[model samples]
Target: MSRDTGTDTAGMTFLESTPKKMLNAYLPLGAFLFVLLFPFYWMAITAFKPDNELLSRDGNPFWINSPTLAHVKKLLFDTAYPEWMWNTVVVSVTATFFSLAASVLAAYAIERLRFSGAKQVGLAIFLAYLVPPSILFIPLASVVFQLGLFDTRLALILTYPTFLIPFCTWLLMGYFRSIPFELEECALIDGATRWQILTKIVLPLAVPGLISAGIFAFTLSWNEFIYALTFVSSSEIKTLPVGVVTELVEGDVYHWGSLMAGALFGSLPVAFIYSFFVEYYVSGMTGSVKE
Candidate 1:
């Protein structure tokens, strides 16, 4: 009888301790997930809800009634969403490719070459990134105007590189520094040119950093509002951020549902790209920081 009582007390104690331990382990994780996901959840829900339901005072925060596809349809058919989307794609893809190309070459030169003032040049490039776009845009506007690219996609594609290349060059330089030079030395001894070594060996090793730089450049162009807004004035030439905010919002009559829908859709491409290459993205970002 005493033995049975002891076993019962031990089992009860184990059960109580197990839950406490599990809670301690998972509570922070659960809270973090909720905080990260709640805004996305709200946006998705609000996108589906009808205008009347969205504006309802008695509507539940966590649940919506009378869901409709009107906002999605309007965004797709009744607005310039498609044009804006295409413009964003063009600008982002063009800017990203150019930025990556420039960054890779610049980073390779800075990392491999033992020239005078190389370190200072690299630092100056990074400091260029620190300069406020507000101050630079005025000067850039004159350059774009002189180049006959005003109110055109060329204006954005050309101007985006000025900002992207500097930071991206700095990022790739750090990443390239982390790579050992022994591999390149051997390739050089085997009659490989600098261009050949970069194309065949260094580039393959730096794929993660390249992808990271490309992703950063793409996201920067995609989300850039100030430059896009300041440079492009025509409705047909506007990119997503400026187009969505200015064209979608009618004075004080805000279309929250449609606006949220546009934002959600605009973010989908980037989200998909990031999700697919998340491992490389993480490695690249962390590796650059470490170097």
Candidate 2:
């Protein structure tokens, strides 16, 4: 066998040029970065910008000449922003916990229980996630009202699991399927109960999958709008997304500074979490791809 050393050397030479690298790699990345980050940049600048600069067309819209803490102060003091943040945290954490617990059980059962029609059952669960929340919200509204859970954190916490459990279960099923069956069989031979195997053996190895599912579930619950709007009516119980949009903007007037401030602050936690778990997230996603 002959190696195509000339072709390889030519390809490497082409990539070695700074201009070629800039055109092929940096340019596209620059565009994508600009598009992805512009909104956040705008939001950050708008939060600190004085009203004159924000509204007036006389100066630079991209940078603030004089930054002010007014928006942050106003957002924290004038509205139920703090309450909204607390409510979002509570609902997201509670719902994510319930959904993950249920998903782990369902995923393990489907992947490990050796049940009849297991593949079909797993497909059905994933398909359930495809159904739009908009259509489900109307019917869920009736159920919420009948159960007297309307306008409360309990309403959001419980209803969130409907959408959350299906996706989490599907994600976790892929992860669980990747585990070697021989390991599970070994556990069984050692007289470990199914629950013990799940809690001790499977869960320990599936940490990345759990983190991915949790991050997704928590983010969904945090930014959820329709269910938050439908189930919650009170300012105190409203989550960050709903509270920021509804309370910050009066019918005809928009508090641009405060609105941007609320958005900026509201997004920080999610960003922080993504930065922290991004490795596990990528691993969990690619883990299923390999299986």
Candidate 3:
């Protein structure tokens, strides 16, 4: 009985010695979740809240007294929002596709070709990615004007690759490096051409990496403001980021409800994509390359 009693006391002491899970885990997690989700919650509420409630201070600021779809209706019917959505999708997808194709070729050549000054070329590409879009837009604007591509979706598609290619190349270089070289050697021994090896073996194995790069490029293109603002002047050709801010406001007056609605709606597609492929994104970033 005494031995059992001692054992129970020891177990109780061990339990007491353990760090507090509430403080170490749940508290931090809860706080992080609140911080992360608070903006979305605010945007959602603002999107739904009637203009009277949005401007009024009589009720709880966080809670919507009455919800209406008037703002969404205005955004959809009264503005060129649908066109902006279409433009955004077209530009983002096209840009991401071209960027990924170029990145795959560039990354593969840099990592596998073993050519002279390969490391220098890779480093230079990454350095180009580090260049600010704010600076590049000035020169890019000149080129866009010269090419007569200004205010066209084709302009965005072509220009987005300038930044997208470098970053995607850098990301894919790391992923490609993680892949075993033995596989390529074996393919070469089996009389497979470099093209066949890349298409059948390397690319198939690098789907996670490709998806990660695609997501990044797509998100960047989707949210791109400076180039979109600078290049596209017409409402019909403007992207979501540029169109929402430009068309929604008239001089000093701000349409908070419509603005929030536009932002919330515009953000949903990217959020959906990210959530859907988050696991692949994680693996790609972590370079889980298998033999």
Q: Which candidate leads the pack in lDDT?
A: 2
Would you list the clashing residue pairs of candidate 2?
A: none
Q: How do the residues 1-291 of candidate 3 rate in per-residue lDDT, one tens digit apiece?
A: 013333455334335434686676678999999999999999999999999998887979899877899999999999999999999999999999999999999999999986899989987997897799999899999999999999899999999998889878888888788789999999999999999988999999888788888887788899999999999999999999899988998788788999999999999998999899876556544442321
Sort by lDDT, top down from the best: 2, 3, 1
**Candidate 1: worst-modelled 10 consecutive residues by lDDT:** 1-10
TM match of model 3 to true structure:
0.89
Superposed on all Cα atoms, the candidates' RMSDs to the truth, in angstroms, are 8.7, 4.8, 7.6
TM-score of 2: 0.91
Count of steric clashes across candidates, in order: 0, 0, 0
Residue pairs with colliding backbones in model 1 are none
Query: Which of 1 and 2 is the better model by lDDT?
Result: 2
* Cα TM-score per model: 0.86, 0.91, 0.89
Q: Could you tell which candidate, 2 or 3, scores higher by TM-score?
A: 2
lDDT of 2 by residue, 1-291 (tens): 013233456445564689988988889999999999999999999999988888999866888899999999999898999999999999999999999999999999999996899889888887787888999999999999999999999999999998899878988988788789999899999999999999999999888789988988888888899999988999999999999988899887788999999999999999998899876656545543443
Index of the highest-TM-score prediction? 2
